[model samples]
Target: MTERTAAALRVVNAPWLRPLIFLLLIVVMWDLTIRIFKIPPYQIPAPKDVVITLWQEGPMLLREAWPTTVATIWGFLLSAAFGIPIAMMIAGSRTIESYVYPLLVFSQSIPKIAIAPLFVVWFGFGMLPKVLSAFLLGFFPVVVSAVQGFKSVEPDMMDLARSMEANRWQIFRMVSLPHAMPSIFAGLKVSITLAVVGAVVGEFVGSNYGIGFVLQRSIGNFELPTMFAALVVLALIGVVLFWILDVIERLAIPWHASQRQDVFLAA
Candidate 1:
């Protein structure tokens, strides 16, 4: 290829630029296909229609989005709070791992959607149920990742710390935690995204105030544009939350290989 063409390809393929370019390409394809086929809006609204609906209903969508956002945050925080400690315990004790690991797997085997109605019945269509649903969905990944992180610390490192007269707490705080942070952050990112789904599931089962509710209302009325707009809002929420976690991870673990590699790539 010519040098100019190769340079253009490199610019387009930059890590941050590529996804945006691909998304734009997808939207263009979507619009073209719809125009060529003369598809009915009811089946799938054009991207422009979805964008217009988002603009017109921005305030209402924002209002509904708040509850889901709140629930997702609460659930994710709770998951991290409880999950990390539990993982630490499991990592510290083979007994605890033996007893609890099977139960965790069993719980995950049961579909959250199937038991969502149970939460609604017990919590009565309130924020609590939604938060609980989010918690359940987001909890597992955090615990699993944390346990792996903690367990991955080399025994020799612990021995060296102990030989230097370090107590258990000091060893954990200085050695295990720093080493485990990257893995823990990985889990947190996954957990946060799942928490969003959990909140929506809770709303789907029984709640009047979330983007999920807006979606349901729009579907009932056959308002495809509004439904698509709700979906767009949901996607934005997940993307924003995940991006926030990624930023935090980079800030918190800049010394780690992953963060260093990201910097190298960006540079």
Candidate 2:
């Protein structure tokens, strides 16, 4: 291959490079849009201005980020911890599934954002409201995904385990749980991102600190660049959390078929 073609081939083979390039391209487009439209910085600051805002406000931003991060993590863990067990109860007993599953589905239909203000009113302006708001937002997906995962075990595999005289717990531990892991992690990745949003919603309703609170304060003072900077931090939080989960999923289930799909990318 020619030198240019060989270099292109190498970039294609490295998984992260393409996305990095795409991100740069979008930034360029964003800058151009502002310049072409003569958009005032007060309305939408340039990327460079945002970078400067981040640099100037970095420490304060980090300080505020901790509360939201804690809330998100706690809410996500709460959903996962409670969701898996509830899912087990649902999958293990058809009667309970019939009664409880509908209620779960109906609960998800309610607008979670509407409930944020109520949480604040009840819990005051503390972390509890934020964590509960996030839990309410993220709980459904975890339960649904966990239930699907638990029920997804093939009958034949279950039968083979039973035929081998494996006790119910043994069969579930060795076969069912492992089989459900990929799905459970899938749900977790989605739930964590949602939890971040939910936590921010709570902060928006009422909070003394957090990246979300920063956004609210910036808006009142008309510090658009600072507001944008806060948004960037929030985005980074979600991206970082998602990436961590992705790594965990790979480590936890390396043998999964989706994890083994590198051959297609390499090709």
Candidate 3:
């Protein structure tokens, strides 16, 4: 094998090593920056202190994080349930597109945090508001991506399907739907991360639970290490969620062009 092939094999076989090394490098740099500048812990706790905090408070953090994780997943599922059908509806007809598309675009322009309070008012101080926040953040991307995916089917393929006496539903099922998987998956990857952010924003605004609430409390109390630790857990949640989606995408659409490129890059 060529050197490129060997390097690709290493990455494929030892997937965790490179990321771990990078994490260690970041921790080292973070520690060095604080030490070199004599920065105080209250402003930016050292990595050692952060690590200690993480160990000390891991159980409590995990308990707080559970609600946020649930809200994130529930919101993501709701967005997917609504977004795909709405996208198909919009894509299926010009009348529907003209009526709904502009409103969707307008909603996207508004900052999520600005409208989060309204959701709280409508849904009250419950998980519903957080779920709605996550849904609002996640919904638009799926609609856009699914529409693109549906419309991306080649003209020649459509003609072939028509010639073969395929109905609209049949054509969509066999060609358009498959063609759209990669794009849908792409939207889902983005939406999931945004869902996490949405949940945190909701928690920050009004909740008495979640890692985000813990973070806010830490900030108020000036517990820099606890704040840093909460942030670390939040980061891990996002990374793990994104990775899970990526894995699912690869498994679901292994024949997609992007997946083929990924395989080529890997080996």
Candidate 4:
């Protein structure tokens, strides 16, 4: 390999160096912008101020963040649990797809926030409503991705499998499902992020617990720093969730094109 290629690989795989550098750059730019614009702390706190806020509010946020995280995780799991079967049915039968696809599209088109109150009324203000909202947020992507993935199986591969006298289940398990793993994972990653948003939205409407509830209360009390701290916690939750999904994807489908180190190197 060329020296230049080696250097690039070294830099990319160093991990901490790049992230640290990026973070430092962001902090410098943020500090500079805040200083130049003289933006008030109430309006937009500086990185340093936010850090202080995080430290000050850590104990309270710790108490609130757990319930929200739990809700997000459960909602995402439920979405996957229900969505995968529906997607499989749709992919396996054109009749089902024709009947259900439009409904899926219509449901997606409807603004979720508009219907959140309805969910609260139907399911009540307990964890059920929040989980349902999150499930709604995560539902579409899994189905869509699974359908596409199943349909994307190469015809030649299917023909080869058929020649081997593979049964329908065998064809799906060996060919279609494996081929679609990347797509399924793509949808899963997107759903994980949406799950956090859904949980927060659920809390926003009416809830006695969760980070979103704390955030609402902070805003009501005009506690800017606390709000900022809550936001940071939300962001951290999202990052952690995404990372966990990424790890799972790697474990589940290490052979997928998306997991290809060569692709990463080329990019």
Number of the top-ranking candidate, with TM-score as the measure = 2
Candidate 3, residue 186: the lDDT equals: 84
lDDT by residue for model 2 (60-175), tens: 99999999999999899898988888888998899999999999899888898888899878989999999998888878888888889999999999999999999989988999
- How high is the lDDT of residue 225 in model 4? 77
Q: What clash pairs does model 4 have? A: none
lDDT per residue as tens, model 3, 1-267:
599999988776685787887899999999999999999898999999999999999999999989998899888998899999988888788999999999999989999999898887787888988888888888888899998888788899999999999999998899888888888888888889999888988888878999889999999999999999999898888889889999888899988777797676676
RMSD vs true structure, all candidates = 2.8, 2.1, 3.2, 3.3
lDDT against the true structure, per candidate, is 0.94, 0.90, 0.89, 0.89
Candidate 1 achieves a global lDDT of: 0.94
For 1-267, candidate 1 gives per-residue lDDT tens digits of 699999999998788898898899999999999999999999999999999999999999999999999999999999999999999999989999999988998999999999999998898989999999999999999999999999999989999999999998999999999999988999999999999999999999999889989999899999999999999999889999999999999899999887798678777
TM-score of each: 0.92, 0.92, 0.92, 0.91
- Give the best candidate by lDDT: 1
Clashing pairs in 1: none
Model 1 lDDT, residue 39, Cα: 95
Tell how far residue 131 is off in model 3, in angstroms. 0.9
Candidate 4 per-residue lDDT over residues 44-132, each given as its tens digit: 77788778889988998989999899999999999899888898999999999999999999989998888888888887889988888
How far in Å is the alpha carbon of 255 misplaced in model 3? 1.1
